[model samples]
Target: MSRRSRPRGAATAAAERRASSRALPQLELGRPTSRYGRWRAATLVLVYVLMGIHIAHWRIRGRTLAPLELNEVMYTLELGVVTAGFLFMATVCIATLLFGRFFCGWACHILALEDLCAWLLKKIRVRPKPVRSRLLLLVPPLAMFYMFLWPQVLRMLEGRPLPTLHLRSDEQGWASFQTTDFWRNLPGPGIAILTFAICGFAIVYVLGSRSFCTYVCPYGSVFRGLDRLSPGRIIAVGDCTACGACTAVCPSHVVVHEELQRYGTVVNPACLKDLECVAACPTGVVRYGVGRPPLLRGWAAWKPIRRPFDFTWGEEVWLALVTLGVLLAFRGLYDAAPFLMTLGLGVIVAYLGLCVLRTAYQRDVRIGPGWLRRAGRVTRFGVAAYAFAAAFVVFWGHSGYIRYHEFAGHRAAAEAVALAERALRAPGGETGGEPHDPGAVPGLPDPTSPTASSGDPMDEPNIVNRSASRAISHLEQCARWGLLRPPRLSDTLRRLYTLRAEARVALSDLRGAIADLERVLRLDPGAAGVHYNLGVLCATSGRDEDAVRHYSHAAALNPTDPDVFNNLGFVHLRRRAWGDAERSLRRALELQPSHALAHFNLARVLAASGRPADAARHLAAAEQLDPRLAQPADPAATP
Candidate 1:
């Protein structure tokens, strides 16, 4: 019988067999959904809210929050010190070694922000296409080396002492919970917020979610290294239908199914451990468990790594050179702007340069054009490229000029402070024994004073006041331009204020001195020296209450300093708080057995408390330590 004449049931059976034979192996035909993803989203939102609250509190109250960026670790490493941020990063690296790049998928603040950007794009029907370039993988390692390791190596080569591990334990500002001038402790607000936008959102919009991690993040390189040895992984057991669903859902563009099929586990360092593959599998073959060490997998077991984009070897070399050049060119721009912004700017410029070069090349080889026409095309292309290049050069030159002016201002301020400090240190209060000419310092002009040429070096008050005023002017210029945003620059401003206060004191401008000292304290409340100086200034100006408060702060900042304790005692004695004065003076004596001034202060406190014999013993000891205390009796003598 012909096929059409066959019984209906037999025909149906035959059709079913044919359909089964043609069936293709695939993952379940649906979008992968996971409870883990929901959990991650919820956790990330909570973390973001808490961080926002922390930053808000810091901004409003001027308090130090925990250091949150990899740059902080770089800063600590540059100084040969280990800060709390470095320890925090080290802990994350350890966790990566055990659990893979879980943080990248679950907890990283930047990634969370990028995901939000991606979701927004998706809502607008602009699905982000994942971009992968093998050549770009070189960035993270290079960044890590340059940012965190190169400085230490350079210091060593320069014969510097090994970086010290300065664990900040003091409760003033270094301690985790202490209040600080947070705005002064880190980069300026412009750089900080712009960096987040560039790295977290702008990069995502251009290169896809987590592009910063794949191509730029220095800390991600550290995590990638540790993740290779991570035993925890997603494995395919029994059988896995080679469905592309897992790859579709992978934000990192990892070939998840292929990795599992070849090595029986996902060993890609980029694997986020997001669990989407397991959730999407229909055959119940995918699982999460401790596996054989990923490093133990033989080379033969490795799958062919395919990138979404490919480049010729020459292209890769050119790209790498361009990246290195940009990195070198923008080395110190981090203080002025975000490193991400600098890198992004460099990338944009390099890409445009390449495009221009390629256009010139194409124009030179025009097929149908005569030699004259080709020459004209080449000329036009050259002019356009030159103009483009010139624009970038001018931009860079303008930036350099701004930086130079800022540097000059800082140098002038520093020179003024040095001059003032030298006068302050002169023996017998000869503050203006010899005026140092500001013009002598390189890159620093003389203060524009009408009397500068005619001024007498021995005119102590005029010289001190003029130098301090010049310093204040320079620092104020820096502040106005936001050049004093970096921690080092802010500290310079603080020192400048303190120096100006000293100059004010020399000129007997008590109110000006107090104002300058107050500014100093506001900039860096934990500065023990500034606090002590403020206390002395206040006490001399007869503001005993203000003096006591400043003295207490000084004592808290420098608990081991006998001078701080001695001054605190003196302030208490001035207030006639005999009990507090006695306690502070004794603590000062305990800190320094040879504190002769503390002995005298303690004797005064003892005499006031009616302990005449004890007072006499302290007085005898004080006179032995320093005969200046052996004076005619005065019941209200100040220490």
Candidate 2:
């Protein structure tokens, strides 16, 4: 998979994709789109242009995209903080979901670093590196650690949005756009740039291929599924003639020929469709097409297509992995045999599996709907899904950090949103056969509905009961994944916490949930959702005083969360503090009048606290608002 192990036949097709890659007796590069680097270059300019807008807002405007930010957009799936640079973040996600990783291929800062590293690697001769066994062991853990921590860091973070980076703002390259005192220091940026350059060079050549995209770059991970789900993709048109050109040219080390035979598209997330494979096809069979190809002929040439990525993938970050492997090997030589053997087996299996899968899956003919040539409504649906995911990523990824950083009136801004969105939030019970204004943005067709907001969201084919149930199930699974861990003291502790807290409220042992969450907070106190969870836990425990404290913190963290206010009010009601209870409940009602509980509780508190006229008014109001709420709070009769 290291691009070198590729059968040495594809060099020619790649010559045309990158003008510079074609340069040589040295190293042949990109394919047909080489000329398009003009626009690609322009894209980088445009990204910086957006970055300029972000800087301008931060400095002259003294504001950034709050509403457009991700967490503000989608807290349902707390992916991460979305950049406060709403326009930039929005563009990155929407455009990417729509157009592929044109941003990364053309303008990503990390991609630039990779390019520099590749250039340096070419300047000298070195063997490609191997992946380290130990890193794999740690990655799953690290990934899990970050997942739990992110929501909390999101809760604790001051603000500015994240999954964002410091804009490298020089005339020639990315520079620091943040004007804050923290970014004034040059060391971190300097080290980062240096690290990128070294890794890029090592990865492209000696350290393995496409290392940056596979291992180091965060943006690449974001765009992988986007590219896979996209309707159009670059593909090998016909027989590859067994040329190695495409493989050699791919920075991500993708097999151009294999893509032509399999899914019939370069659905591989790493594929940017630079089209080196088509250019490398000496047999003149390779061509880019819409769907999977019709004629799947050519196993001789099919070997290239059949080669699975399981092999060279670690090479995507092979160099760092190799370094880590060496370290691990050295350490393992003296340590546990089971651990070392497991690690070794994993590495061996990955590489060997890639080789075997490619050979095993190599097909002589293409598969799938032959008529999928045109982009249809499903494609539009795909586009919408991409946009939704992208928008969420951009917003959630960075929003919390903005809150954590605490800019001028940020806390106030959040509270305002919580009061607005939550107080008016539908509370899941809608009666009038679904509201008309479907909340679809004007001009953009709702992938599910051609009409504007008139259609019932639930009635829509995509959002119908079955699909919604499936979606809810999927989300629940994801949330539950937060608790998985090999048994340990931590696991036991988590179980204990859930036994005491989450179980009592939701009738489930949620101590694991708390343990998992607390672990996250330990890593990133500035995260957005941590305080919110703590508040919920406190409320269920009848610790109103503590609940209020956590609720306020949660409110401070994400003003957009409506449930926070509802709970805050509930805590106040539990304390029997009528005035504060009324205020909290009223605020919750304003945000979401459909909330039967808020109305019921407000009415109950009013009646109990010596106000006949007011109590009668509330009693009438609660029944009208929710007839179910007219009943008393008997455990059996409770909502």
Candidate 3:
């Protein structure tokens, strides 16, 4: 007989086995226990909450935190970028790293609702052991058949337009409706409800336990790769005792026990830390630990219960069916709020109907384990409730385009005006242009005032400052007339400027008009029409600060005219200066207020300073008054 080779460690192994049998050893899987059962619940709620906040930021809903397109900037967070941007791509990457498809588990609101749908559906699908039998097994395949045949079933979107859904939300045909901009401008409460009902159903049945992860999802492969470095992993130990509890609970269908022979101990990427294996390990061998191989993490090492995945098949079938319905039916309904609401109501009623069917089935059949059946029924029922919740949450994709959804900004005329304004203000000031009479241009309306009170008529300040006056005048003119689709401001300026003179003389109390005319003058002094308008406005309004700027601008821009110089003198005379008043009145007589009456006023100023003889001479000559200057001699030097 061949001598049997005995391993050197046999004696020690036997002794250790005997010692192990004497007392149950304390084993630990993970240092901490994180139950996965509640994770799905928490995750489902978070997505809906996030959706709700997004909807509140719309303009049509009667709120506006900012409007960047007005050419009127309130402020900017950055020199060229808006704030509140989303990091969707980044979140996808993070989800890839943990548990392989956790976004489906954690962030996907649809999936959360689906979990409930599965439970409810199970109640309806309830019966004996048909899940693996021909009766129950056909559901998964039959579902695939229906989904593939009618690819348009995924119509349950939060806010697709009615036209897109092939329903007439408005007068337009479906194609025409799509051509319109319903997607970008609208939101309603109905879409939210629809999303909840359909997505809820998908999570309840079909794929069963990690259904989205196993079939339909392409992202699963990506996640599978990333979870290779998951801090928690599943492993098989020599002490496993050949028990099979881990396989029963696994939602993802990863063979947890097979790792013993394949990988030195056992660690496949399939483990999701669901903790079923730890409880099922009768000898407490299968465990989770950090670093090195053969370490598992979850609740198993410290407790009991065969850890089978809460996996079921209601999920995939449901997703396939609901996604199909939403994609098709939910399309064009978004345009009208009422239509969307009606469609949402229809979906809610349908969900209830399905719920009734499922409940009857569950009560009749004793097919699955108590927990699974309950989960199936409960999950499916959640579909309707979730729809209502989501309807409230999405508000019809209201926040989808927020934070930087601006279209390409290339409107030519607006650009030109903005560019010109930007160029002149950076210190050097003037953008020189050859002279041209705008009044001669065709199609250009003769400028007029919106109100009687317009431009300044007071102040004889340095109007002769040629360069500054010319530059400012040109810009002002451009601002009033250059921008296409000009806002109401230009016309209003013209109105005030047109009536400036009367505004000054009558104490018209049109002080605001004079102020506006002054701003226009600052922007464009060479604008004779505006200057003419301003001088008239100020002389009447008694807005002296403004009156001076406009009068001087008009006087300088059209200096060849004696009427302007004469007007200038009268304004100075009104301020009660003696010699200066005389000089201005003299220039007016020389340039010509021709007997425009400024000289008559000037004599008063000179006389106030005690030039009695000069005052008497002018007073006697002015008795031949133009008569038109009678009613409002502007009593005293209020200027």
Candidate 4:
């Protein structure tokens, strides 16, 4: 059976050449057909219909089965929420152990999306050339580590314990099984659309069909590992013809004939077992069969691991750097892009980046249907691509700038807060009372000015002198950028303003702090914490009327907070509004019976109103709760 003597239909020269080049070659024995396509298509359609009904049930009934998303594996690992997705993934893994990787071929929505995109491109006669790189193949497994293992690693580093595993119902909110908020774990509408566009369509068009499964899907990496132990496989059941038609029809781009010839079975983890090859085999040789798993096959199993990569060493390095840059630039861009979408975007950008570089340096380059460079000259198509890439680079640069400022501001603010906390906790610094009491105003040595130092570097006053200046500067820059671009950093403006207020408070600038808090309210009028902080600042500044107003607003926003009611009571007591003062203090005690501050304040209100008996009882309770609230050594001193 010499090559020339074998049947021409068995292995055409063109088919052999295409197979060697790792491209989809036309079959000599007519176009290869898929027996499983219609069934898989119908199954995918039914899956989608069921998904719609699930969403509808949640909408109409207000609670339903939790979303069967694979990513809920994160919740199971990090928070110990045993979600439906966690159970679903466990079921699939068990099934894969017995029957191989059929879920991906027949059930995955993303796979359906890639297939549809490929079919549409075929209609237009556009065959995408798949780009293969060894470095790019590391992405999925690396992503799997980040998704499932990194959080636990961080928790260990931070000396945190694992969360307790528990089930929850809808009434508890954000539950695992029956969730009222169906979209809580899902991405926003904009992100969902972008995910579909990039992962489903763009990656397929740019890097060939099923590119997402190969280069970006973290879940696929898990399944691929599990597939190594699966006994179910596509094995040769009959004759010895190698026409390469099975490879031509494989949507996953697996070289079916090569694997079969080397291992006597489809051992590639990339094989989805869609059975396209079974239908395409002219001799009826390929079929499903039980066999020893790869693990049990010993050293002989390693023979089929000689697939050639598409890039040289230098080009691989370039692809790695470009892809990493694109991933960092696009991930969480404008606080919207999700990690998976960014990974797909990275692959596309890396491909285009290489094409652009080739257009400039290499000869006879073509992308899609257009010649980018030919005969060492740049064509009009090359210029157009260059223009588009240039615009994209500009956009990337701006996004980088915004991210830098946001990150820097947050880092500086964190340092400032740590410094201020250290100073407040220093020996001879503000102490006596509970540091966390929201209703208590600081009685500083100099209420009207920043603390004066005795020219000692180690002095607490000197330590906090410039603690927040740098933080304020960075935050101001970030805020300015956010202001110029509405909705760019709009979601973070409230947080920025709140942090700035804390920084101002550290500097002993109560007015500046109040102004920043007012800005926070403008951003988020319902923020109870901001209102409470503003009330404290106003009380320290002797603006009793404004303090009462802010405390009232805080109380309305968060009725469960006893601190707000206590603070409002104190302000009313200062203004000599006895009835109002007593009511607020009593409400505070109702929320928290052990609130010493509220008891102390209530006593003051009762004493001012001449209810001596009631005042004495509350005073006794306050003194019992906190002995510091008792009368000082000097009889003239009032608590």
Candidate 5:
């Protein structure tokens, strides 16, 4: 209901009637007789029913239309995928331009969730008081900018060319309008639950109905802007009585009667065109109709409609700063927190912070008719509330510490891996067209030799070693912190193990690297890339049998990967298994006819089987494919 709407108590209604219509005859305010809420609720239910059917179709058919989410605009901006979400958002924007945000009022699942929470609270005799601040309301627009505009701005500044708009099939992943993996863009189960709890239930109970749309939803901000230009609006169709019933039933807090009185229409952008105001107007004066859009209203007819806010200007500033800080603090905490969930956390925490301030400083403070402080003295309730707020603040501080280490560890590991890749690269592109098999770092620092003292820092083995050491230390520390409070996703811990394994490889600690990789496989046995990497490491360490086993597993998981077959063939050749080696090499050649390493290995298999003519033919093919294959010191020479 409208923020200034009086409660349904007789005394409150009498006061509102006397104050709002002192000149006219007094009229009793009555509850809305309209069934718009029922219709809207049914429409929202149908939305969910369709969503369920869509998911079920994907499960049974193995493909479906991509999820229609406004946030998919991010992929459109960054990757140029003209997704179904992008088209849906555009259609909704156009609809808002004509219908004044009817979708938000009648179709959004989040709105349904908020209304359900509000209903449940009312059933329990709780009416959550809405907290309004000038600064906090800017959050929606700011978030809209961050989500939809910032990526392109960053790309322009970085001088990167915009990606070509293109479509991808399900096999290619992240298709524009269709997908095989339906949940690829969705959050994990834990994150989904947290999102519903925080954004749906917690925000509604703490900040009142539709507060997320007002203070946090980026998509709502876009619609709000479009709503200003829509001709469709609540307008006065007849005259006279202003008993304020229209204002008393507006769920968006739009102060409808005041708008109709001031501008002869509800010009407030917050209006969702729910028609509650129209249904509640006792005089039948208000109705929905097309008129001149708010922008077209001449200044002479335009009047400033002042509405009261819950916070003073200084408190609004404090609210904005605290909310921003808490938002950044909780965002992606434990690698599981989603953005909307974190935004709700920020708003709720900011409200609690304000309550603490008021209880501590203000005289005669009450929360929902229960006095927190009386006559400049604290009550027991006040003390308990203060303690709760303090504890929550401490919890947030600890979360910030964990998030810091997670980001730091990832940053360090990325740098170490990049440096190690540079260190391992051949100096002159000597491998030609041959695939650089996984886990092969050719120019690694020799375990027996002293560190290189080259003048160029890039040529120094000591620098690479030190970077790898630093990465290992950070990653280990990150894992230690994670153990103290385990993340909701096992993938986070799995990634830590995989990254640490790469660092160990850079340091030439083959045994330590194998242990870390094995731990990763335990966490995710179907990790085909991990299996391939383990195979290369085993082959490098002369465990041909183990190498063959891992390579075979990797091949089974990803049969289309030609490099897996080629590397498996090399392992077989090392074990002198001529028939198995020839079969594997031929399979690799069939997958990729230009695979130089497979041809080179087949040459060895043929020679060992006493086929000199075939050996010479395969050797000539390998040399023609990669001129560097003719060189003596090439490591693939004898494998």
Candidate 6:
């Protein structure tokens, strides 16, 4: 009976070998054509064009389209409002639920940038190997929570009221095409370029093309979760020989062959639905279609192929703790560094720390050579590591120094603006007084004169000029240090110029004020407020033609602003264009019925046009709105 059983087993083994040999030939498959590559490129181009259009519309028409950032939505959610960004994110989430991360595969701008990096790496014949670790996967979810959920949760815990749900349309939309303000929205060019290199290119060069998507992007976590319940999936049909061709071409490192063999579908969330696997399959068995839910297969569906470097549960726990701790430790550095740079720095530090601990542990255990040899090896490694770390520290310190100067400059500029505002509101003392020394303290009354209590309408003591000088000094220092170019700090420079202009106006330096205002206009060409200010300055200097042009521009940019219309009418009245003045004054009154200045200005225009009855009615309305208009003009207040 034993002989019969042995013979039967040998016969069955022989039959299995024969069947396997006959079923599929050992065909060595080459690289498959990237069928979706063109589609991805097209989609990326289209998205970019749309973004450009959005920026153009904002710059040209002074209106906002929807924002394109998922982080914007997260920010709005924290504020408990549904902005255009939120609506856009909702649309993406719904589409992901239906089609399974198609945006990540085809439309993401960052993904396109990363893919371009990958293509360049391929040109240099450098193919990166993927580091597969389940522990690393936790980062995206943690980041998602940190960015989108934690702020609101903390607010709730602090007993803060949930903000009302509303769209945030107050500011010009998220991204700008205006070169000056556009750079302000991003990290400084230096830091931005570094981020693209380290997070996008360097990461992909070392840890594979999809490494950032897999381990860092918070938005990817949302899409990954939605993809699990998606109906669209790649399923196996017909003859599948378990050939590894499909797996070889997967940029995301998905075990396509094993997944197909086990569950007859690609159930891995990392599968980007790139369709390279389907194109690479020799048997033509893999195709995208509706399939049974992978979850129905239970535990068997998730059995993963373990690699040699796969982390044990203990190691995973340790790594996770270390990563979280490092992330918290470096949170304050985010303003100095871009988000991706911060994440990459945290990862590097955590990895290095873990390496040190691991080396020490191995040394203590005598895992390799004798104590002396191990100690020598460790010393060599420590020296190399220390050198790299020291260089990194120096670079970090330099960056911190730059950020410090930027902060100091911004603070000084803010103080200058506050001082200027106070000087503007302060009561003017005696007119035709000697100019105070530039070094004298502002907001102080002159001690030598009996009429010192009466403030100068033109700030004749030079208080605003002194404050603006201090601001200009700080701004110049910032510019010298190259801190003024950062988008975050550009507005400070603009404010500095504006403060300088106001100071010039108070000093009766009309030409200098005009030059400063022109600089401000160049920096923000679409600023309606700046246009209005320029119009006022031009009018004060008797440049009636320039004032008319500037006021017309201000009105066009902000048609709803009654001040703009009123100012435009005032400029027209100075030019003695009765028709234009009357029309603009009526429009201003239409916008705001209680505008006394508009009523008085209209009365003057009506009187100039020989309409005594109309002029009398408007004069009465002006007097009722503001009785001060009925009083005789004070000689001291005249510019």
What C-alpha lDDT values do all the predictions have? 0.65, 0.44, 0.40, 0.75, 0.74, 0.65
Which candidate should be chosen as best, given lDDT against the real structure? 4
State which candidate has the highest TM-score: 4
- Candidate 5, residues 558-600, lDDT tens digits: the string is 9987878888988888788988988988998999988888887
Residue-level lDDT of model 6, residues 34-108, one tens digit each, is 666666667877877987887787677665554556666765666565655576789999998887878887787
lDDT of 4 by residue, 1-639 (tens): 234543443245336546776644553323433557778888888888998999999889988899999998898888888889999999998888888999998899888888889878887778887777789889999999999999999999999999998887777655788877788778898789889999999999889989999999999999988888999998888664777878778778787887787778887888898888888877888888887778778866743443456655666788888878877776765566788998889888888888887664455577777888887788999899899999999877766676666666557666755665665432232212541233433322223334433446566544444444555565566566542443634444455455445544545667877887798787778988778778888887889889999999999999988878988888887788988988998998999898887887788778777777887788789889888778533221222
How do all the candidates rank in terms of TM-score, highest first? 4, 5, 1, 6, 2, 3
Clashes (backbone N, CA, C under 3 Å), per candidate, total 1, 99, 115, 0, 0, 6
Backbone collision tally, model 4 = 0
Q: Rank the candidates by lDDT, best first.
A: 4, 5, 6, 1, 2, 3
RMSD to the true structure for each prediction, in A, is 16.5, 21.8, 22.7, 8.4, 8.4, 14.9
- What TM-score does each of the candidates earn? 0.56, 0.35, 0.30, 0.75, 0.72, 0.55
Candidate 1 lDDT at 298 equals 70
TM-score of 1: 0.56
Prediction 6 TM-score vs. true: 0.55
For candidate 1, list the clashing residue pairs, or say none. Answer: 80-163
Model 1 / residue 498 / CA error / Å: 16
